[model samples]
Target: MAHQTRIPKLASILAVSALGLSLSPSWAARSFTPQAGTWVISDEVDGKPGRGFAIDVQGNTFFMQVFGYEKNGDATFYAATGQMEGDTVTAPLLRYQGGRSFGSEPRDAQEDKSIGDVKLSFRNGLQGTMQLPGEPAKDIERFIFTAPDAAYYQTEQWKTSSRMARWFGLNAQGQVEKSWFAMLKTSPTEPMRLTLSDGQTSETLECSLTTPSDSIRCVAANAADAGQAPVVKEAQFRLLGAQVAGAVSLQAEGAAPLQLLGINTRADYPYSGGVIVGCCANGLESFMPGTFGYAQRPAYQPSNGTWVMDDELTGKPGRGVSLDVQGGKMVMQVFAYRADGQPTFAMGVGDFAPDPELRDVSSARFSLQQYRGGRSVGGAASSGELVRDEGEVMVQVSGRTGGYGMPAGSLAEAMVQFPGESAKRMRRLPLQPWQTLEDQLFGEWYFPGLSYAGRPLTVTLNRREGEFVTNDDGSVRCQFNTQMLRGECQWPTATGTSGSSGPIELQDAFALSNSYVRLRDRYGNLVGLGQVPLN
Candidate 1:
């Protein structure tokens, strides 16, 4: 019996040795495929919430997809592939290809120049330093992936987590009551649908998910709101999970970006500059294509804690600006000059009430007094009390743009008459690489110099909330398919209005020219699509 036991033990030892040798360096370095799912990641840095890593595993590696607003209020999104060996993960960023992919291709460093290599050595719970290129090593804490139907969602824990409520838009109930969003199942294995209703109409779109396993996306969808067909409605959310989801309608371009929960969706970001000065003209940028748009603007820089604005135009006579805020008092001084070295400086001093609480939302109202410069110099008229409405500096920057030349100080911003049309109508946006294109499609349809029914008239197409209508004040045609999704607009009546003429039928009348929209009917075809402009 003892001999038999020894033989068995020897056999067991041999088997264990064989297993250990097989799991040597070669085997260990192969790959570790983690369960694919949605990961809500954040840091102890500010405790902000953000969606993270969606990965798919194959035999020896994983394909990755991540999209979100970063801490700095910029967007980060891309696709990549990487390998995991134990707790170490390393991969290079790749260009995003749609549903179909050729996974066998080698990583192209030149082609995928936008994204850098991703490497990390993690401890337990997947928390570690993400050593990305260019950026310093980012410390990621409590970074873990969970399925859409994560256990925390089923319970009440996630809702109580700070920032999570705001991220999901539970805080928006204070603004509007009927904010609605739903996760829909179109087919058994088909991609899920996220539907948003904005009273007048609803916009439905497929979730930005490629796989049916588990995923989430950062997206902006066009909503059929009370406005026209091109009116865009946006809401950010994790598309799936057992927990009840929350969403808020994002504010329009000119307003501060509504928080997209975990993503930093603030539309207007802070940019540091010096001071603003306007003597003869408030030099706001002109969007006109020629000489006006190319005019030189006064420069500004920070001096100690105050700001100095100077046109620095060697011989061109204009104004120098000095702006300073000490304690709660603000002063704006415009130093003007004549071509013959004559001086016409102006000064406006006022008090600014600062909020000890909610400093970001503090309001500032001031009426700049014209202490000098009543003369018209070099054909430019100058003088006025410029009243700046009180509001948070950040809010004022976006809510009142194009009026102040990028915050450093707009020379024409305070001037009432020097820049009349351009300053009043111009709307400039902070430059961002991530694009939202809905606004490019709205406005009037212009078919220049036309008289229908031998009478002077204008033909206009109206796109309002899922309805496209032809509104010709003249004798123009308005025949449409009458069906919404069939790609047609509102039809003109059989009996003509005073200036009404032929009723031209149209199919897919709305045509796109990069950023602008055009009406494509008989009038459009005759006049040419490119010739028709949206004013």
Candidate 2:
């Protein structure tokens, strides 16, 4: 069978109010502190956070209430019956909803307390009938919680003894009789190695991590080199919990320290222009490019930083719009077109009815009609999808797989136009074609359902030989240059419709269309396509 996995959600128990029958009279006799606070765990898989409540009844019965779901946003809760002997407690499931439960099979256990010589073994399988409320209970197709190494509470704060003693809890058990992992950095001069140890045997893999700079510095070696130095692009591992320090750097402006603290390193992933992450390791989300600090608590606070459009947008047929962004708020000024192509709309954050031609304003997703090709429109809203064809945008961030964290990275994007349009006139519009995974595509794309925008399932493609390939292993290992394109489509019509008047809702109504295409090197570094028009 394949590996069964559970994506971690770093959700904090906001609150827990348990009103129930008192513990068994025999339990009350002992000194048992029913711990009912918050416990956070990071799922290294999705880079998103998961949350739940842990309620100890009379220090004997363990109740675990999981409120967070996977990327699909589902919720699950389970209760187990077991005894707490000293610091160790193992509970079997008596009743479970939204979890894997066989006819009378018990779920896993939860222990806020630890034992001195604890060798806790956690087993979570997909061998039970399950349901998602409306769906009938069936054997789960994939069991992600079976990872054996997924012991809980191996936090970064735990001292060497805690780590060596295996004092932490295991979330799930892996199928691999033995599993191992090694850690490494992404710079050329950095020393790194991969070490693996099965219960009885151990192995270590060694290699040099190089960047573009190293390739130039060693030209003589390049001629006789077997191949390009193996660049450590992405790497990730469970920390139980670890104190991690991270930062984001880019050539364009806008990236600054984000000041995130106490993030469960679960749901962390690299995206187009930035990284998606969850704090406290509870729920999953994304972070714009910048620096980050991780641990058991918040490390810093964020400052109010803002930027304004370089020039004023004069409307089409007229002048376009002028805009500014401050403290997360957007300001716009509209000017009408003049006979001499001068500003016709109002200047300086002008307040006027929005453009009538802008269709489906309230919809979550919208389509770009068409743009005059090769024109760079200025402004944040004007920054649409980055396309690979033009070689403009590229991906700069990475997931934790390579120790290249998935939080706080630069965010930027650009749009493309149809080939037949004039460059000057096309510069006035925002809608364009195809999206690219550039340094700006670094942020994220959120879909309420299985796929994004309810059209074509978006996948980051690494261009092989003028074609696209999926990062199945989630790592980019190419012998030649490649581009990472964040592909999404425009919903042109409805269930069976074709053009603009087809579908009203975005769920599954989108027709095939290119949002944007980003360009990247074989090592997964972003290379800009063209300049965005600021005025």
Candidate 3:
């Protein structure tokens, strides 16, 4: 467990007093919202696998369902729902029985009785504690399966990394519009470029990197009319995680400068240069992509793909869920084990709806069903019949939009109930690499428009070395560690003698779907895009 520092009460009071503020009752209280997802007992995670709590919070209402085992190792579940005060909630734990099971007819589970009361106290969004009846308080935390990239290509080598930015401002007709910005940036030394589009026309601008005063000066990158004044003068903003909020100064032709408040979503660390800097030219405010009023704005959608429970990827027999969304309909299949340890599955199909209070969250509820009498794979033909109303399942998908209006930062949590059992919480698994460094890069590659002599170039690479042969009988060799993704390549002069050598960098070599690797020089200029043929 990670250690956390606790501030002394007297010290906290002294610190607040030093800020020259009165210690009011409201000011002394702390508030927190528990992030909705799967949580586990921190210390007992390894010893007690297959047991966890699914917790969800909307406003001050808290809901939790625990799945575990009885003394004889029989499966058991419990549920609790209550309103939270500050950062804590206590509620009665209830059990149920007589729910429908696989191959069983439709039946509703009935509440058996209250077992005991449970207390939950949250320290923050990700960490908390839980106290069950007859058990000591246990430390609990959100199970995080996904971790961000630990390294990135330098700006000098990549030129520009593209990301989607959410922009909010009034269009040319003086009506507010929520749109997207194609934000492009190199390193701190290069100017930040932005292009705002409403799915029709677009406006572009170039702005300096964030200044000391937390502002960026902008100028027209492309002007419709020559010798015209720049469309944007300046912008001042703040960056919090992936969110950007601030105000911009827009200059209309023959009009006074207009100050418009705006907010944008930015890429994660190192790419954003730790500040908000973007702009747009032309009359973008007048063009709204969809409707005029914010009420008619389109909701963000989650991308359709395979999702897994992050912490449970042990290549062992465990629970998993498959989600398929088509238009407004969603179908989920959960594969797990029965109380007697037999493998079983439940399916749910329903419609997706956006959360009224959370812009980034969408949900669906389905009547759970199970099937039986199915044929085995590659066996005799057989049909399966559904056992309706086996239970209920609810899924919540949370995500954000990025470049090309695609889903980014997508996360999902599900509350699943079986007849006679309590709901269980499950979360989408994080991305995992399926290929090795050698599998991705060891081969012959072709680069077109790579030679100064106008001849196509072909390079052969092994685990440790790469050779580039020129059309003029000149050859250069590079030595690199594929695991590091960096190397040095020697340059041959006109006389066919080794002249100079510089560093070589490649990006996204192990990307699962990539057919090529981006090659760049030490100064970040594009050397060639190396493509490998399909086997």
The 0-to-1 C-alpha lDDT of every candidate, in the order given, reads: 0.27, 0.20, 0.41
Backbone Cα, N, C clashes tallied per candidate: 21, 109, 9
Tell me the deviation in Å of residue 164 in model 1. Answer: 29
lDDT per residue for candidate 2 within 316-395, as digits (tens), equals 11122222221111122221211232111111111111112321110011111111111011101111111112111111
Per-residue lDDT tens digits for candidate 3, residues 250-354, read 665554332232323223223222211111100012223576522221222232223334334444324445454432445454544444434345545565655
Q: Which model scores highest in TM-score?
A: 3
Q: Please give the lDDT score for candidate 2.
A: 0.20
Give the candidates in order of TM-score, highest first. 3, 1, 2
The regions of model 2 sitting more than 4 angstroms off are 1-61, 64-78, 81-83, 90-93, 96-184, 187-535
For candidate 1, what is the lDDT? 0.27
lDDT-based ranking: 3, 1, 2
Check candidate 3 and list the clashing pairs.
99-419, 99-420, 156-524, 171-285, 171-286, 172-285, 172-286, 173-286, 308-429
lDDT of 1 by residue, 246-300 (tens): 2334445553333221211111101211111111112223233555431222121
- In candidate 2, position 76 carries an lDDT of 23
TM of each candidate vs. truth: 0.20, 0.18, 0.34
Better of 1 and 2 by TM-score: 1
Model 3 residue 211 distance off true place after TM-score fit, in angstroms: 28
